[model samples]
Structure formats: C-alpha cells, structure tokens
Target: MRDASAVITKKLYEEDAYRTEFDAVLVSVRRKEDSVLDVVLDQTCFFPEEGGQCPDRGELGGLSVLDVQIEGNEIHHYLEAPKDALPEAGAGIHGKIDWPFRFSNMQQHSGEHLFSGTVHRRYGFENVGFHLSPSEVTLDFDGVIPEQDIPELEREVNAAIWSNIPSVVRMTQREDREGLTYRSKIDLEGEVRIVTFPGIDSCACCAPHVARTGEIGICKVVSMIRWKGGVRVSILCGKRALEHFQKLHGIVVQTANDLSTSMENIFPQVVKLKNERQQLLARLKDASLKELQYAAKEIASDEEHALLFSSGAELPAVRKVVNALCAEHPGYCGVFVGNDEEGYSFVIGSRQLDCAGLGRQLQETLGSKGGGRPEMIQGSVARKREEIEGAIFSLTRP
Candidate 1:
C-alpha cells in the first residue's frame, strides 16, 4: 500500500467554501475497484465525508466523482472512469463541485447547529449525535425538550436566521483556550475550529458553513421521537424544507377535495364519516343476527349435517348459528359468510365429531386458513359453496 499520509492534500475548501473549481496536480492514483480509482491531488476544493455530513459531489478530470473520503491528512477522490482514461500522476487535473448540493448541506448543518444551540441554551441538553445527508437530517439530544416548547424553539432558530447573524470561524489555540466555553461532543487534542453565530451558537466543528444565518433560508422541525433515553429530532432545511411542505400541502388539499369540504374542515369531515361508518356497521350486525336466527329455524330438525351459506353476516352471528345447529344435529354444522367470488369466512362446530380434524382436512384439501378446539373451529376458505358443502356433508363420524 502507498503511504498517502506522508503527502497531505492542501484543503482549498478550508480557505474558500464556495471554491467550485480548482486546478491541481495528481499526486497518486490507486485502483479501488473495477472502473473506480482513488485519485489524490496535490490540492483539492472538495470536502470529504466527515462529521456526520455527506461528501461534496462533482467531477474530476471530466469523470464523475463518486465519493470523497479523508485518510490521515490526504483526501481521496473516488472517481468513476477507466484507469487508462484518467490522467497519470504528476498530470494537471481540474476539479469541480456541484454548488447546489454543497450549499444545501451547508444550510442543513447551519440550521441544525442553530436549533441545537437553542435547545442547549434553554434546557441544558447536549446534542449527543447528529447525521446529515441529502435525504435526512437528525439530531439526537441528551435530554428531552418538552413537546410544547419545540414550536417556540423552532421559531427562535428562524428568528436568528432572519436576523442575518454573521457566522464566525476561528481556531482556538490549545494554549490560549484556557477557559473557553463552547459546545463540543468530544475532548479536543489541539487547536479547535469553533464555528460561531454570535448570540446563537458557538460550537467546535470542522465543516464549512454558510457565511450568515440568513443564507440558511429556513429550518422546519418535522418530528421528534423518544430515542435511547432522550429524543431524536428530525428537521428539514432550505430547499428540502420547501419541497417537504409542498408535498404535505398537496396531501391536505387532495384530502379536503375527497371529503367534499374546505381544507380547514377536512379533519372534522373525516371524524364525521368515521362515526357514520360505525353506526352503519352496528345496524348491519343487528340485521345479520336476525337473518341467522331465521335460517337456523329453516334447517331440518333431523338432518345428518346442517350447513348454511350466509351473506354479509359478521363473525359473531355466524358462530352463534353454527353452535345452535350443532346442539340439534348429529354431524358437523357450519355457517359460511360471503359469496363464491369473494371467498368465505366459516365457523364450524359439532356435538359428535372432532371439528379440529375436519378443519385440518379442509385446510389441506381446500387451501383454507385457521384452526380451533376439538368441538368447534373457525377458518376462511376460497372454494365455492358447492365444493365446501360436498366436503363437509360427506364426512362420517370418526
């Protein structure tokens, strides 16, 4: 393996976060995998994946940069291109970062810092962990922030953003940092890079950020859930926040239209429909019970097996009818609810046979599902009534 630690790539991004283009000389190239080369340059404007933040993406030598990672002091640019097509070591190369992607990450990180700072100030909760990616951003706090206080906390973050506070980046020398108070998730060994938003937050960090809070656009706290002993808060910022809110607004509008009500009354309409559905179901159940009783009276008093096909009857009504038939008949008695096309839910009981065995036989023969005790069984089957009747009625006592 090549000793890349000996050769440190100059970090242009540390000097200028918005440096989208840069010229450099290739220092080394190693094959990472098929069509992927880990190319190191003398200097780079790209930011590698670090500190819970995703790497900056773009192109190097006109080939797509797949990912970036840091090893010791060297930044490895994983490029997607045939080895022969890439420039050799010592050759001049050009690198470009996708500005939109980089800026979006900056907004999210800055927004997170602002929110965490607010929580720390008010509740003394430390940000235990954080993760930032293109699709999601989450901050895990060491203590719970009251749910009611979150709205105010979120408002405070946006208020700071609208205040347009300038972000200050400075290295606190280990010698001069005798009594420095800053938010840090870990103990520092040497000089600490402190990112500060005056009167908002001051935290030890290494990632490049927006010049001012206003550039963050917005921060929307989407959810907070109990995690570990504290809470994990998910937020959306800048373009992602806008996109998320747009989708949510679309759902509300469509739901209101479907409910035949104004957007503001969609909730009330939904509640009303839910109540009405319950009332209708109760009426249907009462009618099904009466129908089952009438059908029970029509069965021959001395039949070998009493079987009835019922429609729209609930499970309780069907089970009641089967139990009543079983008391007066010598063989299996069952009530099936539903038609040939939709499949059937059944309740079978017997006074003189093992219904559990019958259920197993039906399951193996008819592709049905369910089971119960020896005296009774409940299950569903997909076969037509003609096949089900023939199977149950033809059975003799075991």
Candidate 2:
C-alpha cells in the first residue's frame, strides 16, 4: 500500500458541480471491516463529507458508496463490497453521484449562504455554526434575530433566489488575497476557495454549489430557538420547503374538517374545545376530591392509620385526601391511584411518623422511585396492594 498522503485527489466536482459521471484510478484500497472496504480515488467527482454538509452518496465501480471522507489529500470512498469484488489498485473505475440528492444539497447550501450573507449585511450577525442534513438545515448566529424579523430575511433570500444570480468561485492566492473581502469562520491564508453569489454572498466554502441562485427555488425559515448567547434557526429550501408547506396545509385542512369549522376559524374552535375540556376536568376533580375526602372521613377517629385507593382520582385530589387524613390519623396515611396490575401513583402522609423514612423503605424494599419532606412523600411503585401494605406496616416508625 502506497502512502495516500502523496495521492492527490483531483476534485472534479470543483471543476463542474453538475458533473455526475466520472472515471478515476483506484489509488489505494484497504479493508476497514469484514463487510466494508475503504478505497481512495485519484480524480473523482464525489464530494467528501465536510462540516455543515453530508458526503455525496453514489456508486463507485458499480458498488454503492457508503460514505466519503477526505483525509490529507486523498478522498476515501467507503463501499460495502468485499475486496474480491473490487478491482486491484491502479485499475480504472467509473462512478456517478446521486444527482437529485446532490442538487438538493446544492440548493440548500446556496440558500444558506444567501440567507447568512443577507443577515450579515443587514443585521451584522455572523454565522457561527451550521449543520446540514438530509431532512433539515440549521444555521447558528453570533447575535439574536427575533422571530418577527426573520420574515424579512426570508423575503430577501427568496428574492435573491428568484433573481437567478450567477454563482462564481474565485480561487484567490495568499498574495492576491489582500484587500479582498469575504465572510469566513477562520482567517483564511494560502489559496482560498471563495464562492460568491454576486452582491449577496461571498464566503470561503469548499462544497460544490448550484450554478445560479434561481436553482434554489425558494427559502423558508421554519423555526428558531435561543442558544448559547445567540440563536439557532432551522430553514428549508427548494422542494423540501414546498413539501413541508404541503404537509402542513394537509394537516390544517384535516384538523379544520374534524373540528367542523373552516381553516380560518380553527383557532377559535380549538379554544372553544379547550375551554370545554377545562370545565369537564374541573367537574371531575371536584367529584374525585369529594369522594376521596368522604373515604378519609370513613376512617374512624379512633383509627391510627388510613390507606385509600381511588382508581380514577387525580394526584391533586389524592394529595388533598392525604392532607385531610394526616390531620387526624396518628399513623401513616396514603391515597393511591391505579390498579395493582398497573402499579400505583401514591401520596403518603403521616402526622406523628416520618414519611421520608417510609419513602426510603419503599424505594429500597420495592424499588419505588420518589421522595419528599418527612411529613409527606410521593412516588410510584409497581408492587401489589398486599405487598405495599406489608412493606409499610413492617417498618418501625422513624
């Protein structure tokens, strides 16, 4: 095996991003796993995996390329083919990239560049980080950009997309790089590859992009969240954005039909349904609380302990029951909800005994998970009612 460090992979994608079919020499081949082989090519059109973007997926020598990575100057193509299935080193091989996939990626990358450039130009926020996956693209910024202002950015990006601005890459040498302006994460020296979209964006990028902005189709900012000190925003472009909008509209339409209201009235209809749900829950809680309290009272004043289980009772109602029983009961008082088969959620209280001690006993003995103050403890345990009763009664009062 020759040192791949000396094997320079002529990146044909840089020459023409649209070029899908190409032939290259198999410079080096190594076995990474029993089922996987890593092969390096001399000159290839496949783009290796880089930060902010995934590697191009395609076939190399008729075998599916599992992954592509750039190490030193060699572009490694990972394939699931056995060594016996592949040709020997120095053999000429032919492969073609997944064109639609590559085009979509190009659209997304170019769209991101345009949007980031617009934000930098208008709001002066530098793009601090980026991640591009098959399903989504998230761009991080060094400063905050409110949700309300993102519409303007989207409009600007879409306008640029529609303008069909030509995409050009300027290979600037270190000596000629002086006085030239561009957006980059690092202070680039040496020969820098600068991809420019006319007046919109000029940034140091090594990925292959579309020939024109119009090829991006459209740009849409889907969501944003506050991050470290700035914000991370998710965006969709081209067919992806259109598909998203289509899916969302379908959901809205279905929701409106289910609610028996027009799309425009869905919000009010949902609010109405929510109010009805709240009223029903309030009534349920009132009934549950009264029933639980009545059960508590049924425990004679002479009784030292009380344990009540109400299957449909809410936690708040159970807690109230525990509180009422503890006011009189001298021993442990607890109310549990749920059946023996499904386990139970419980609120246990004691006036004279230590509930925290019981909590630990429950946790250690039955592997129950929860804790609270000494006076009260709340947790869930899967033990049957009989087992739980035994565990609680066997422990001496702490």
Candidate 3:
C-alpha cells in the first residue's frame, strides 16, 4: 500500500469561478488493494457529489478521474489506470471537464433553488428533499399544493426568469445570518453559502449554480403528486425543459392527425373511444358465455363421465363451469381442460373415485404434478390436447 498521507489534498470550491480551467500539482498517490491509485491534487475543479448534488465529471492528466469524494475537508480523486509507474507526489497535472454537462447542472440546480424558494415563500412549503441526478433534478415539498396551483407557480417562477433577476452567493457570519433565513433541512455548523434569487427565492446550498435566473431559460413542472405526507414535484429546467416541450408537442401533433381531430378535442375523443371499446368487449364476453351454456346442455353425456374442453375460453372460466356442473351431478366424474397463457389447466373430480391416484397417474404420463383430496384433483401442465387426452385415457383404461 502507498502512503495515504501523500494522496490527499484541499478541495477547491470551483463554482466560485465556474468558467476557469487551470493545472494543479500532484500532491499524493494512495495505492489500493485493486492496484488502482487514488491521486490527489493541491487544488482541483472536480466537484464531488455531495449535498444532493451530483459529482463533477472530468479528466485529469489524460486519465479518467472516475470519482471525486470529500473526506474531512480533503478531496480524494479516484483514477483509472493499469499497473504503471505512478506520477510523483509533486508532479504537475492538467484537468479539464466537459463544460456542457457542468453548465447544464448549474442551470438545473439554480432553477430548483428558485422554484423551491418560491414555494417556500408563497405557501410556507419547506423543501424536505432534493436529488440532482444525470437525467432530472427533483424536489419534495413538505406540504401539499393543490393541482390548480401548480400552473400558477410555474408561471410565477418563469416570470422571475423573464425579469432577469441577478442571483448572488454570499457567506455570512453565524450571528449576522440570524433572522436572515434560507431553506436548509440539515443543520449547518460552520460558514454557509446563501444563494439568493433576487425578489424570488433564497436557500443555503453547497451546489454550483448559474449567475442569474434568466440563465435557467425556462422552468417546467413535469409532474406533481402527493408524497411522504406532502407533495413531490419533478421538474425539468433549462435545456431539459425545452426538450420535454418539443417532444410532447410532436406527440400531440401525431395523435391529433391519427385521430382526425384537433389537439384541443383529443382527450374527449379518446375517452369516448375507450368507453365504446369496453362496452363491446363486455357484450362479446356475455355472448360467449351464453354460447358455452348452450353447448354444455347439448353435450351433457348420459355416460358416467363429464368431459368439458374449450380452446376459445379462458381456463378459469372453463373451470368454474365444470365445478358448477359437477356440483349439480354428484355421481358423475368431471374433467375440465382449457388453453391459457400457461399452456393448459386440467381439473378432475369424482365423488366416488380416488382422484389423487388418478392425478398421480396423469403426472407420471404427462410429466406434471399436483395434489388434492381423494375426490377432486386440480393442477396445471404444459401439454398439447392430444397428449393430455392420451394420458387421461391411459389412466381410465378398462
């Protein structure tokens, strides 16, 4: 194992200078059991995923910096490398990030602050939770806001964006920060970064954010539902918000054309069509049952055996009919078979016969197994009609 002390360094707060790119000295390298080295730099632009914010992704010294983590105010950089001579502790290194991804995160995170702040200010709703992931940023409110109010909230937040209000980040002493409140669920022990969206929202957050509300472009409330005794709102901000609208607009147009109706009337038309389809299905099912009942009466065998088999009907329905018929005729044997998604279900019953022994005979012949009382046996098997009939005939042979 390499010296752990040589591989840890100070975490540079990069959001303070979001656009800057610079080099740093290799401060240490810690070797792990897997042979990969954890390299530390004297200063870094890599932001570790913390405080509900995702980690900054970038490369260092032409090698992929797979992860950035903070331990006791020190930042450790996990790197990907095969076994090779490691860079010296004091070696100079270059670092760069895919700026687009970083900038997008900044915009989305800032938008969340504004949205959460506005909710807090307008409705006294606390932001109880937050998650900044690769796909979307989500926030959970501490209380429910009515469905009718969501669009109004969206409008107000975007109005702030259109106003082009400048956002400011300030650090204040604990005493001076008193009475000047912000949204934070966790207790803060030291200096805090207070992000303020002017005339709109404010919160104490460690995540990187854009300089102005207008930079967030558009804010969209994609979904809102009750969660954890409160409400959870999933939002798409900046480029994500724009992309969501574009995709939904395309779908709306396609649906309207397919239905030969205007987009405005699509919902009512769809509801009407669905109602008609359900009614037709119900009528078809009733007619099929009536036909089955007629067929059952015609095929009622005067012989001691009652055979019921149907490919068109569901197994459950066929079994119910067979059970009813068996209950009506006490001495006769019943065998019900029907095709289903699981291949077939065969139910055999006779008040006077040892059906368990018959079931065992069927299992041995058809490679299936099930058990029941001496008078009735029920089970399922994956077998064709001919194969099942042959098995049953062999068990009942004279």
Kindly list the per-residue Cα lDDT of model 3 for residues 72-111, writing each as its tens digit: 6567778776678477777798888667878888888888
The alpha-carbon root-mean-square deviation between model 1 and the true structure, to one decimal in Å, is 2.6
CA error at residue 91 for candidate 2, angstroms: 0.7
Minimum summed lDDT over a 10-residue window in model 2 is located at 389-398
- Indicate whether candidate 1 or candidate 2 has the larger TM-score: 1
Alpha-carbon shift of residue 299 in model 3 (angstroms): 4.5
Query: In candidate 3, which residue ranges exceed 4 Å CA deviation?
Result: 1-17, 33-36, 246-262, 294-306, 311-320, 323-342, 345-347, 356-383
For residues 1-398, could you state the per-residue lDDT of candidate 1 as single tens digits?
A: 34566888998987787789999988898888889999998899899998898999999989999999998889999999884775678889999999999999999999999999999999999998999988999999989888998889889999999999999888788976678778999989877789999999989998879999999999999999998899999999898899999999999999988888999899888899999999998998788888888988998898878888877888877887888898889788888988999999999899888999999889877888999998999989998999998777565544
Model 1 regions lying over 4 Å from their true place: 82-86, 300-303, 310-312, 338-343, 382-398
Better of 2 and 3 by TM-score: 2
Clashes of 1: 0
Compared with the true structure, what per-residue lDDT tens digits does model 2 show for residues 223-326?
A: 99998899998999998888899999999999999998999999999999999999997887787778888888888998788888776688877887788888
Provide the overall lDDT of each model, using Cα atoms, as 2-decimal numbers.
Answer: 0.89, 0.89, 0.76
For the record, the alpha-carbon RMSD of candidate 2 to the native fold, in angstroms, is 3.7
Q: What is the lDDT of residue 62 in candidate 2?
A: 86
